[model samples]
Target: MTVTADRFDDALRAGPRVVLQTPEGVPLVMTLASVGERAYAFTIDCLFAAIGLLALLFLSLLTQFAGSSLFGAVFVLAFFLLRNGWFLAHELRSGRTPGKRRAALRVVDARGGPLEPLAVVVRNLTREVEVFVPLVLLANPDFVLDQGPGLVRAVGVVWVAGFALVPFFDKKRRRIGDLLAGTLVVREPRHALQADLVAGAADGEDSRGEPAFEPAQLAHYGVYELQVLEKVLREEPTRSLVLDAVAEKVMRRIGWTGDPREFGGARPFLAAFYRAQRARLEHDLALGRARQSKTAATERGSRPSTMHRNSQ
Candidate 1:
């Protein structure tokens, strides 16, 4: 069965599906995904960056103890430059979103092609202006030079006020930078089971089979099980509960007697199923494009024949 892009979008908006692209070219959809894990990872990275910056500052101060102000300034400049460069490179190569979700998030154009390098650069660069007020004031004393003392004090007040209003004004919890980047931060499911179900249904396949089991039948399984089996596909223990005893219970509830072990130990099964479903969808999409191309060519070829007949 072929899942259309509209259906995929609907699932994402509805919060039951995370659409991921394989290292290959297939799009895998899964359910039970969340942004929490990714958010946590980003927090860790931020902590690392903070520690590194502090270490750099300490080293610069130590060098200045020898009365080499020039060397200290040079070192500081180089440190900041390298840090920003690395950040841009990493964000472009992976994506602007931080954490494990970075692995599952697929960057694509409106036409569904891979994202262009220029687009990534423009978006990340815009962060400079969006995050300008806070970043400049925090790091550089020069930011206060142009204004009178009174104006400088007012600017500080405004900055504090703006920072305070951030959470209230932004619906997505984006800071000022995220708003200017024209980027979206979405959570990816730990697994692709939900994506597979929706994609399979779109393609005219029955995911859970005939006579869909009632929600109560899923009682033996916890929320994590449903989430892991349907949402995020990561192998973390917290997200692997579905593949444990919970999965077997779900299978049993559905009247399946096949050994749970036969499904390649849960995680692999979920991954493989999503991969297969994505491949099938892509294959179908390609065939459709091919048919459209052939039809257009035939019409062009027949145009000359019609013209000749009319001229005669």
Candidate 2:
């Protein structure tokens, strides 16, 4: 089903997808990272940090590290950087930490674009206010409870508690950092697309069957063409302008000048072409004629016949 721009709502509950329009008026769908996935990524990141701290301590003790004075200074610096710099550097560079990459997740612009460096900084800074500062206090209960000022301690407790629980209230699973930064944690899209672009053609023709593409027609494309076509299909808006554009290009490539109306819609026509092209490539592969791209197919001297045409 097509999600129209007019009725574009995140409240659909159909899935964790955020469907928005890009600056170029393209309908973009971003799959939000699931809560479980985010949690798993977080746990892994914490594990790495802990392991790093332990390794530092082990090294310092092994060499005595010029006594406690030098070791204490170095330990504090390492702890601070590990707690803060790790997230900042990774996000600023690639928007994905080691954990996020492992979990197939990355941070992105909530409005559907590239992650900004400022946004990364803001989000990670907010993270300190939300979690790490409170954690530091909690780790030292003797000071917070017995010696620290009651009001400051209470406020710190409340600040961290509220931020911690707020994401549970949000459907998007956005924390204080995400809200401030206008960023989203999204699962990465896979390169290979499913073959469900057109349903009827995959099984039986409903009433209008698209014309079968001959081996010569299929030979106009290869694996690269299949990938591009899939991307077009995935990102096509409710208006379906891209669909027509790509369908026209495919028709010209295969030299099919038959009635466009006969194909029913551009989706089915493209789906038919995709299926045929994929099948042709697979068949060629079985015979050791592996065509990796359209350029490779061309290098093999494929002779497409425009003289012969198929009509439904």
Candidate 3:
């Protein structure tokens, strides 16, 4: 449960990253640490950018109506600048992946910390040139004329083509900008806590406050049952099959006659069992730690008494 950052990096570097069910029966997968937070932040930024662009468009029209073409052009330029700036900001703030953050996605440096802002900015901003610029020129006739004659157009074409091929040459699936920036995208494991053990119990008020399973009850279950349940939760096998299989296995192991189908839902039931197990393990660990502390305190308290007795 207290895996160090170095051990995590070593695991990743060892080979293709995988989520292994720990002995305690929890699934572990590498995902962005704060993916949800980053996604929420990114969404807010996109919304603000959209609002600003709309406001700027309205202002640009008003300026054009007032007979200042220069102001209108500047407004248009600002529109593009702010749009690209928003994207860069989102990428830096949200890391590489877009959308709902999951436990299985993470962006970290080789040292296993959040990436520096500058590196994120550089890699993302370069995306504008590598992916966006050519598409813009090809899609819009105006960009081609703005650059003047055929030679500029030809140069644009070549630049676009060359940069498009950068991903192939790079070792880490990095493009040109990513190569220049000292960064690599990797996944981080989701945090596993003892509290997660009671994930599914009852939703109603009576069951709400009740803990999943007592420590003694969990200790009674066989090791294989624990292992299978861990696999079901971590790998998330097909909902029904995994659920039924786990229910049947655990019931047989514990000699319970309750129908597996009566559990209502497979995923929820299995998840709850795993959580109960985790809670039990945590409870035991806490008790052990407390006992050790008490023993140490008793020894310290008796040290002087022992010395006095020896002198006598």
Candidate 4:
């Protein structure tokens, strides 16, 4: 448990992190996006809104009989849609609006799960109060000072300040929209192939030795376990005791009652197992067999062939 906690802490410190546990009990750490990144994304969104408004203005000019009131109504509707609906549409589709894509950010549930359409809608709709209302009030000082009474101006100022200050007080930098919607803006986590961990080998032998585990020994774990094992190897390859424990766990899981010294050491055994599992998964993928996580594979009603068997 201490080791698990340490890994979690290390992952969080390595980047901004949202920690979630996989069904197999592995901690999946998703990187949280920085405030600066979110601000940049918002700025990009505002630019898109500006471009949309300009197009609407041009269209209004092109129409001969479109009166000022008609133009005003159309422009307001367009602005509202661009401001709010844009996020709603894009987030629901890919969890990324154009701005978020450009900034390498994505909206997900607070637990780092997939984004829900309802959450996206709620967060974006609340932006009217959290963002635009304050912006509009600040932009048009004359209306507040002259046209609107003192109480109205004061209320606008307070509303703006209160929402703006909410993030400063929250640990995750959650604003009113995020708090209400239970969402998070996080840096998009990219999965890179860990070639370095399995790079060096002779014709088929790892640097330490030839492959120790036979096909049957490698059959007990699937891709998700391989991914976690690969992470452990990459992060702490030299930690022999840690590797031995992992090896023992796998041996028990697969009913392999071999001596620990059979593979020279746990690290080599794990490396050989990793290579085999990776190759199997790649082969399945090439054959158009969709292998998601182990849980997903089970849920899809297709048991994994080759070396992937249900683990204990």
Model 4 misplaced regions, further than 4 Å: 1-15, 21-26, 59-73, 112-114, 142-159, 203-312
- Model 1 spans > 4 angstroms off: 1-43, 57-70, 96-111, 135-182, 192-312
- State which candidate, 2 or 4, has the greater lDDT: 2
Best-to-worst order by lDDT is: 2, 4, 3, 1
lDDT of 3 by residue, 1-312 (tens): 111222223334432333444456654443322323443644655567778877877876775653677766876777777767765655577764433233234444433345788877776678677766766767884664575777877776777867856655554445666666655444544456543324335444133243245454455442223443564565545465645665556545445554434444555555666667655544655555211211234445332211221221
Stretches of candidate 2 exceeding 4 Å from the true structure: 1-15, 66-68, 134-159, 189-312
Error of 1 at 164 (Å): 9.1
TM-score of each: 0.39, 0.54, 0.44, 0.54
| Residue 104 displacement (Å), model 2 | 1.3
Local lDDT at 262 for model 4: 66
Model 4 lDDT per residue over 1-312, tens place: 124334534334544456665456676656777777888998898898799888778777797525778778877888877877888888889988899999988887886455677888888888887777667767875654566777887886886768866766777777788988898777875677656655645445444455555666655555556666776777765656788888778777767676656666777777776777777766766776635444554556443232232221
**Candidate 2 at 177: error in angstroms?**
0.6
Task: Report the C-alpha displacement of residue 51, candidate 3, in angstroms.
Answer: 5.8
Q: Which stretches of candidate 3 lie over 4 Å from their true place?
A: 1-51, 62-66, 88-114, 137-159, 165-173, 185-195, 198-245, 251-312
Q: What C-alpha lDDT, on a 0 to 100 scale, does residue 76 get in candidate 2? A: 92
